[model samples]
Target: MTWGRARCALLAIPIRPNIRGRAVMAYDDNNRGLLLALKYGDKMEGVSTMARWMARAGRDILTDTHIIVPVPLHRWRLLSRRYNQSAVLANRLAELTGRLAIPDLMVRVRAT
Candidate 1:
């Protein structure tokens, strides 16, 4: 599906540095589980939940954001797992905030 196509294909990986930067994350309390679930546990159900939390955290800047870009997965990882957590997160977040998910802006020179 086109939902996580960018992430599925493997390319760029977006890293959020701060709230004032390109991305805003939700909850700093014990996020390893949540991230792991989304990344490797087949927790697609949490996309909406995560998007809601992300939206809440980024409410102040949602208006400033035009496109929600997902951090792409490495080709090898995607080939093996067949999914990308960041892709779904970005798409859901964009849908919730009425923005667009731009998956091609940041191109990766090499997979990390």
Candidate 2:
């Protein structure tokens, strides 16, 4: 799968229990700005683009997906940030893919 000119890969870490994973974009110079802006600058306008990229990159996995869940933030972090970027992306992705988004499906027990 691919998004723009960036190549997508199915990431597998033998030590991890998960069977597969896919990154929407590489954390390189080309994508760093947009990622940082979305995560820290409240640049929500880019969420649609990012979610679309994710859908394209993970199309195979999504074919079998039943629900979309965002990695939750710790309570303190949630308070400080006032929003979870992952949740934003998850919601947008749900909209694009016609899937259910359970933004609160998981919770961070403590700060990491």
Candidate 3:
């Protein structure tokens, strides 16, 4: 999405503390498979590549970033999945950018 569209989309969502957001790539047919694999197929071999893309895409934000926190998964989902794709990406990004990855900083009080 264009910056204007992205901004408007973000504005519509209720996020705590209101932070800027970026998309590494559009979730189109070209990237849907890779994304789905990482998110649901337990295929993490592409995480490093994806994180690199994220670091590049969010370079501006990373310059001022102090910590990388991945959104937590619900307890049941975590149990079934055996891992959080977001945390994996966060940790990989931290390794590439020298940022701190605090995977447990956020807790999911309830399932959405």
Candidate 4:
């Protein structure tokens, strides 16, 4: 996956659960579920759903690649948000695919 000033992209390799040359890499808010629980508070069902999709879309890539690279957020953004949403999704994806999710491969280059 790659991220630029305003864009984030994922490289999808064709394999099972997909027959087309291209596939979706990221999840938009449109395709998510909201689960409200008294004990667990608000939960994003989208996480698991997206994870399954990621695992299916990248099944072939996972077998060939050694690591999963998730785009990093700026420290300021991370602090404000308290989490790197991409990293969370990436972790779920790696877990679903049974692959090692490596978040340190790419560093967030601060704008200088």
Candidate 5:
């Protein structure tokens, strides 16, 4: 199934692309850099790639969205991890798209 369909179980819908083609969804793929970053830290290239995607995707998604809300992180996890990938992505996205990044709209109570 598509990412949109996959998210339905949680009552979440993928943000459809606006006039431009963009959607807000999780980055489920584990690129080499991301895997490294997970094991190491932001020193990996994942940050740059993730940042680029966010900016590009944000522009497309914001074409129809007045606001962008990222998948959230728990406070403890946020602190422990020292970073929220989705939030970082959203922040870069908001800057590139000129859209508001509402990071607090969604909260993650747990992870599966």
Candidate 6:
């Protein structure tokens, strides 16, 4: 899952040396619609299903994962949407995978 590959599902970030690794589930057209609906339609239940799939995709890395941190959304976007999709997924992943999830590791400085 090295970054050298054109499209690796797992992101092996060099800067974050403490964390073991990061992985992504399928990102094809099938998932795109479901993700978009979960992000914009306030479909909270999707979090569970997504986490299950994410957990399956990332099961191997879970053992080494101490915590899960999702990419942040802009403040304005968060305010309007009332939630961050990534955070939702992370939290659910935390619950299902027994790993801690930190929703906000950093700030965007300003709205987009």
Whose lDDT is greatest here? 3
Q: Candidate 2 residues 6-105, lDDT tens each?
A: 3323443222223366997789999899999888888888999989999999999889887888899999988888899999999999999999998986
Comparing 2 with 3 on TM-score, the higher-scoring candidate is 3
Question: Global CA lDDT of candidate 3, please?
Answer: 0.87
Report per-prediction Cα RMSD to one decimal. Answer: 8.9, 10.1, 8.0, 9.2, 7.6, 7.6
* Per-residue lDDT of candidate 3, residues 7-60 (tens digit): 323358533343566899999999999999999999988999999999999999
TM-score of candidate 5 relative to the true fold = 0.56
Task: For candidate 6, write residues 1-112 as lDDT tens digits.
Answer: 3434434125643443344544455778877877788889988877788788788888888878788988788888998999898898889999998899979775666666
Higher-TM-score candidate of 4 and 6: 6
Q: Which stretches of candidate 3 lie above 4 Å from their native place?
A: 1-18
Q: Residue by residue across 74-97, what tens digits does model 4's lDDT show?
A: 787667556666777778887877
Per-residue lDDT, model 6, residue 38, is 88
- Candidate 4 Cα lDDT to native: 0.59
Alpha carbon deviation, residue 64, candidate 6 (Å):
0.7
How far is 100's C-alpha from truth in model 5 (Å)?
0.4
lDDT of 5 at 2: 48
* Stronger candidate by lDDT (3 vs 6): 3
TM-score-best of 5 and 6: 6
| Regions more than 4 Å wrong, model 5 | 1-30, 35-40, 44-49, 55-60
> Cα miss at 36, model 4 (Å)?
17
Clash count (model 5, backbone only): 0
Give Cα distance to truth, residue 11, candidate 1, Å.
22
Give TM-scores for every candidate, taking all chains together and pairing residue i with residue i: 0.68, 0.81, 0.82, 0.60, 0.56, 0.72
Q: Which stretches of model 6 miss by more than 4 angstroms?
A: 1-26, 110-112
lDDT of 5 by residue, 2-107 (tens): 4344443355765443234454344566465565574347554455566566566555455567777777878887887787776766676677667788788767
lDDT of 1 at 105: 53
